[model samples]
Target: MNTNDLKIFEAVVESGSFTKAADIMFTVQSNVTARIKSLEEEFNAKLFSRTSRKVELTEEGKILMNYAKQIQHLVEEAKNEIISNETVNGHLTIGCMETTMTLKAPEILLAFGEKYPAVELEFKSDNRDSLISAVLNYKLDAAFVSGPLNISGLEKIKIKEEQLVILASSKEAGLNKLLAKEPMKSIVFDNGCIFRERLESWFSHKGIHNYKSIELNSIEGIINFVDAGLGISLLPEEVVSRYYQGRNICTYSLNKQLGTMTTLLVYRKGKAPSTALQSFIDMHIEDIA
Candidate 1:
């Protein structure tokens, strides 16, 4: 119906609870319920199937959600386009892989902040897959992820190439000795991580399929586990060198095929970037190129 109705609907869908949506909208539960009821009545369709715990979107609601998101994005884009260049102030949410956040984000973000102090920036760290999903869903304006992306509705700019390396404890003399270790445990981020996928591929290439993995969410945790001789891991060389750099850790380079990965700044295709996002892209493109 109205933009306010769509906003409330989006909030309820995102939070999955009427009370939670009300809290997000800074309104009461009754107001949220009334808005949803009005929308359902107006459309003559059941929007959400409700349970005591939460609500699930119905078929009609799913279709409406797609349109609602596009409308919201277009509204925001129009506002950004009409605003004067001298006042480029808005929220910019970016998603990033953990390793990229560690090695590349700080300096760039610092400089961007200095230049555009009024623009709010929020950086969320996650695995490549999750970050991509967030960007597709319009939860992130853009993301820093590994390159060679072939997904539809996404555009990417190459930021830099990073050499991937195998990390082990110093107690291991060489790659051969490390591979010969019993159980062949690996320290890695969870399933959706690009590095973890590469680690698995490397193991498969070497005809080793029985290795065990210790999944962690933190880059520091994986590095510490590798340093403790608990397991080996595959990560960008810069990440290991910059973050750990401990005497207990040893780095082994992958063969050229597995060694190289490009970090890319990815955003939705066909959408004009917000002024703040455009500024970030312009600032980095030359430096990275």
Candidate 2:
């Protein structure tokens, strides 16, 4: 029931190792282990399945991690609000994809900061899957991501639409024809990316199987490899425009028949949004409308 114990548990989960968490907190590894043990004893539930190499969260541990994050977020928000006047100040954590960070967020972030200078913006950028998990875990106040996000216990609003495109080195001609004929070499984000999922589904439906795929973690890395003629990739049109415009890349629409994917603004349901969070969402609603 002690908040400090929850924090210690959270640190262990986030750091993925007691030794690493101890190092982060400038404490001894044994101390961190003792805190986790105390918490497990209090809850009468195991938190982690520990091995020599790695620590994996049990189902109970995963549930506790989610609640711990919520408690941490609430504590931070309370302090920030109490310290502020009639202004939006304090930390505002947001999660976003690298592609969305490049294409969609800069102008919005700039405008929001200008209007609410007291607010401290904290950003976490990664693939879409991690972004969703962060928001769900209360590590983020909100996130801008591509959707039909169907996660339980979350609220979402469709903010915009973006097209997914297949790109190759512009010098490498006839990519569109090649895709129709065979699956060309592809560079993609890991399997969790929506574009990657959609692309895979599209190929499967087309009965195309003549492709090799490489998984890259970053959008920039994927584009770099594609531009070097290492492979082709499917990316959001806006991301392609921002990163690969005027580069040796050509884009083909991934079948307008598939329709436009929605970009969503998401937050945890039932949790009241802070003034700053509401303000940010309102601005997007106005802009998108």
Candidate 3:
């Protein structure tokens, strides 16, 4: 019914709980529930299917969510435009893959921090699919993701290309020797990771369909596991070189077909980026170019 009501709705949709949305909105659960109920009544539809554990958006809720995001975006754009002549101070939430967080984010963070100290910067490390979803939902101002992207409603800029490699313990001399280990394990990120998907494809290409997967969430954890000979992993060469340079690890290049992936900086296509976000994008472009 109003922007405040829509804000509560978005929060509930994102957090998937009226209680959690209350926590985010700095209100109580009853208020969140009342606002959602009011919105549903106004629209003459049930917006969410509630359960004891969580809430799931209904079909009508999905439609409203799309328009709610647009409204929120427009509201922010208006605020940004009104303050265009003022100091460059705003919040930016950026998302990226864990590998990029390790290899690329530090320099960008350092430079951006020094230049725009007034802006608040928050970074989230997630897999490609999660990052894409966050960007699409207005949760992230921008994201750095692995690409050859073709998603609608998003704009992308190729920032860098990383060569993918098979990382193994230094005890293994080569890829074949590493593959010979019985019950070969793969140390990888959780599902929805682009690198993990590529690793699976590589295994399938080699007629390997039954290897065990050791899912770890952090880049350091994956590298440490690989170094300990617990398993092998597919990761960026730059990431391995940077984090495990002198450790007991070796990397073998993948064939060209599966070897390279581009890192793209992506944002919503039609939305005008906030001052802080636009400044960060400019700095990223200059840094990478």
RMSD (Å) per prediction = 1.9, 3.2, 2.6
lDDT of 2 by residue, 1-289 (tens): 6777777787788888999988887789998999998888988999999999879899999888877888877887788778886877887888887777777667767888898888877777776888888887777888888877798877898887888887788877676565664546778877677777777777777677787889888888988998898887787887777666878898877677553788888988987887778877788888878
Estimate, for each residue in 32-87, the C-alpha lDDT of model 1 and write its tens digit: 99999999999999999999889999999999898888889878767766774577
CA lDDT for candidate 3 = 0.87
lDDT, model 2: 0.80
Q: In model 2, which residue pairs have backbone atoms overlapping below 3 Å? A: none
Q: Each model's TM-score?
A: 0.92, 0.83, 0.88
Clashes of 1: 0
Q: Give the Å shift of residue 178 in candidate 2.
A: 2.4
lDDT of 3 by residue, 1-289 (tens): 7899999999998899888899999999999989999998999999999888999999999999999988887788677657756778777889999888888778877878899877778889998888999999888989999888999989888898889998889976777976776677899999999888999999999888779999998988998899888999999898867667898998888998899998899999875677778898888788778
Model 3 earns a TM-score of 0.88
